[model samples]
Target: MKEEDIRELELRAILEASNDNIVIADGKGKVLRVSPNCYSIYGMKTEELVGKTADELEKMDVWSPSVTKRVLQDKKEVQVMQHTLTGRSVMATALPVFDEQGEMIRVISFSHDLTELRQIKEDYEELRAKMEYYQSEIQELRDKDQHMDGIVLKSKELSNVWQLIHRVAPSDATVVFLGESGVGKNVFARAIHDKSNRSKEAFIEVNCGAIPETLFESEMFGYEKGAFTGANKEGKPGLIELANKGTLFLDEVGELPLNLQAKLLKVIQEKKVTRIGGTQTKQIDFRIIASTNRDLQEMVREGKFREDLFYRLNVVPITILPLRERKDDLLQLCEFFLDMFNEKYKTDKVLHAATINEMLDYSWPGNVRELENLMERLVITTENRVIYPSALPFHTKESQSEVFELETEELPEQADNLQEALRDVEIRWLKRAYRQYKTTYEMADYLGISQSSVVRKLQKYGINS
Candidate 1:
């Protein structure tokens, strides 16, 4: 075959194989051929859209790329962004088709729908911001009162965590955040979305445990204007609808009622929802990130949670260590809370050494939220920053627990068996702390040492980490 005939066949093959919605426009901008993908990309049928002029397409918000116009004039490829008749956002790249004579005989363009990609990107960016700010804050938290997860530790465990987060921050995978209550799962969820591709979209949070069973469907799926007597006149959109093209976080998801579990499963599976009293199904493009304190697998066996959902959400599981595991960070939280309260109350005060010592001894059962409340209260109740043990709510408890501390107490210089006495003191302190706070990291803070140091000391004396 002649070189010219071979080039024509090559051009035909290129047009046929393109996955993008493609169209050809002669120099005068008349429609020549539209690719097969064009119908699917526009959510329309082909026969209904052939032989339309560029002006006719403009009525449906379709037009050649600005660059395409330049391409036609300059005989080059041009890219365009426009909305299709079906409302899908599209991007088009128009390449001028030439004959053997090198004259522009036609323009071939490829287009793609960017709705899902763009929405996910928006959600991702929003989640990334959350993760970035909080991840950075962990290193800077003040001592005494702070969220455990918000506190950064100089440990391989935490180093691994940061690395893992960075690895997983870019996708829309359903994440199952595993952590104890008050370990900041919700915060991490927000961070994931903020750091993700869906950052520009809305981030909706749903606490499954908080929504009652009878109203779960209506609350989550929404209802029409007259669906019920109390329904909004304009018909309320469900959380799913509100979160369209964004992120929907299910907090305490293990607590979701069983009757509604199937509904959630459908949404995750089909990516479509039918609001209450509404017949039409609306397709959604959103990412799911769920957090839970309860053991979902155990619940599945107990018939309280679904195993399928668990498997689906576990695509990416991030487990956060409890506050007790990161003892190196306790003082940082204390100072963070102290400064926060100081600024809020406009007080120029400092922590009393004795008061801090007492605080370290008491266990924080309620986690970060508990610590924050304590600091705020202490700051408000106390007259000065020179906080005395008496100013704290747990002072009496600490005094009572002083007996436990004596067992592991650091020996006095007056004692010849100093090391043994100090060992006893440490044991007593650890016991008292375990009884008060559920976390060992909290105990380590009370002793004012790295948690591993505590573990090592205890191990030397036959203690558990």
Candidate 2:
């Protein structure tokens, strides 16, 4: 072969063996040439893309947002990483080709398959999303940064309770909220429902204490039109029916009568409920959250409540401590409720330090509910820019037990007159030693209580702590 023939053969070999996708197109962006590398990237042969316009690969699902914009805008070379019109990832280089006189005559595009790199990128993105979800859920369980609407809180005791609720709410267990009326058992129930699998369904709450016995059956298990003398004409679906796939909170469950206990038991045991004076039985699926201040277990022993139903309903127990026991959470809760009621009442009456101290000192027998009511009353009734201790409904007094233990100071001598105060000091030091000192010896030195005394108190308190 001649020398030019040899050079032409070499050029063809160079183009065919090239690793990058090289394409030569007309000035109008019609493809006229394609190199071999185009195959690996686009899942197509060189000849396939040669005759098609760059815009014609719509069916392949490739998104080819061309560097055409950049090149056209700047009238210069452009480099871009984009998915092809057929959904293939490519790193592309585009430039305008000019004629001998410097007038634009053609356009050339070169691309390389970056599908593997793109796959790696997508995998990272999916992983990042999963981590974000896990982190959010973890935060919720800790109640550290708890959420209400868009709010986040870090109340210590409240966070502990929030985390416990998240852990317990998902089970098929029965939860009995122990709090004063209006302490927000209903809110807790709603939170449980929100975290549960049945979140997509209804949430029904029935106040057993509020409704009379005559209407109990109609309100809970449904009723035939004539089942009661004055029932709805077409008949009404009870709360049980309305709460088909979600949760039903029996507030004041202590008020449910003895006769109705048997009925409610049947519904819980068989997952079915019967309508009053109606023969049909319906299968029921739901979780139960019951709340009351009454001692159901004690009531059962006293013959006021059924033993079997009490056992069944106590599947998963969460006893809410009264606000007095969780004094660590009082200030935090006060601040939160203040901000909340401020928004509701559209007022910014700040609580005075003395009033806050007074609020903290009182033993809230009614728990959070009572505190909320007191705050609402103060907010509504007070006209001053600041809340005063005088605004409190009653004088702040220490609980009887606390009042009995008050002393001028600790004594160095053991006297019968100081026995009760000294005993209180001994108990306090025992707790402080075990928890804070992490050793009995150090606690004994601090409180002048013996290691043996600490040991005995720990046993009396039934503490392994």
Candidate 3:
């Protein structure tokens, strides 16, 4: 073949093999040539469009608003999205060809099929909406879970105590909480009231020790109008009267004087109260819950507390153990208090692992209240994101060793032989070590015993930890 003819044939082959749909039209908008791929993009054979005009193709319903016709009219390049009757979406660009005299000769158009891309974009949008909906649902469920799981108590004894509180909360029984100061007695009292049938009513709390001896009767039962000197003229209800149909929590009930104990007992037994200097006795309906760190039985024996009142108030007794004994719940309480102070102070502070270990090793004599205060102080005083042991307010050499010393108790003297005495000592040490450490491996490491020996001793001694 001639070199010029070979060049022309190569150019024609290049046009036919293009990935995009190629069409060549005359300046008058008559289609003169089309690539074979036009069948895939426009659902039409190339021969059908070879000799057709834009006006004729419009009648055949191949494409609307012809790109070639637009380029011919404007005598410039034009790009547009196209819709064909065959339901294919396409992007088409048309350019006008000009001769040396600046006269329009032909128009060429390139088109890309966009139907699959549009479908994929639609699918992605739908999936994004579904993910957003599921995320909202998960957040809602997590909030509900936190609410339902009220107080954090992990020790077996404390867990049992919580279960007992729930069981007795539905009734109108008088409950007495005996524990050390700051051992969360009031918290348990509120929990009981919240879970009871009278939850909708007010839960009134009174510190019996804070009230004066002379005003104890008037403070507990409402005084009538002008009943006493300096009393409210309109007559105000007292703690007992204010707690009608609800729960009255008398904290430090052991502080009530011997003379007033008889009167308080009469009011509780009869469910009626007579205010100071008042003639009429009014009926009161309420549940009474009392808490005291003192031993009421010892007080009764010592003639400081009334035996009758003690029996009346002790319908169900729940004693909360000190914080040092329930070591399993230390981390949980720390997280709760950290979250509380973080929200209050608007700071995101976290405790370091060493700081947590130090807290676990210290004897918490002030119990949950002390931990809460310490967490708040750390958040306010510590400027860094992580809290270290040196920053703790109670960090000291004595405090670090206090927990272990308190865990050990005096040896029982009843053992007859040296071997039996050694066995008793071993049991006591094992029990204390188990309470301080979480796992058998930890206890073994702390006590200088093998892990297998720790397990065997725990099983032999009937220890459930």
Decide which is better by TM-score, 1 or 2.
Answer: 1
TM-score-wise, the better of 2 and 3 is: 3
Q: Which ten residues in a row have the lowest lDDT in candidate 1?
A: 142-151
1 or 2, greater by lDDT: 2
In terms of TM-score, the best-performing candidate is 3
List, residue by residue over 1-465, the lDDT tens digit for candidate 2: 999999988867877888887877666666777777666666677777777765564344333665543464567898988776556778888998878887766677777788888799999999999999999899668554454632223445556677888898787678888766645677777888888888899999989899899878888989877877777888888899888998999998988899988998888888888788789989988888888879887899899899998888787767666677677667767777787788899999888554665677787878777887888888889988687666787643442223222223455465566776676676654554455456777656645667887677788876644
Residue 16 in candidate 3, Cα distance off native in Å: 56
Candidates ranked by lDDT, best first? 3, 2, 1
Taken over the whole model, the C-alpha lDDT of each candidate is 0.73, 0.74, 0.85
Each prediction's total of clashing residue pairs, residues at least 3 apart in sequence or on different chains, is 47, 3, 0
Instruction: State the lDDT of candidate 3 residue by residue for 7-80, as single tens digits.
Output: 98886897788988888998788999888878876778988888999768867768766898889888899998
When sorted by TM-score, best at the front, the candidate numbers are 3, 1, 2
Report each candidate's C-alpha RMSD, comma-separated, in the order given.
Answer: 26.8, 18.7, 17.5
* Alpha-carbon shift of residue 37 in model 1 (angstroms): 85
How much lDDT does candidate 3 score?
A: 0.85
Candidate 1: stretches off by over 4 Å: 1-156, 397-465
Q: What local lDDT does model 1 show for residue 437?
A: 54
lDDT of 1 by residue, 1-465 (tens): 999999988866876797777677676666766666676666555555466656566655554333345567778776767666666777777788788988887766667779788899989999999999987787456321123435444445655765676577688788888887876678778777777888889999999899888888888888888998888889988898888889999999988877688889989999998889989899999899998988888898998888888888889888877666654445556777788788989986677555676666666666656777888888888875476666777777656445233323455556468686675666665665555555557667766778887677767756454
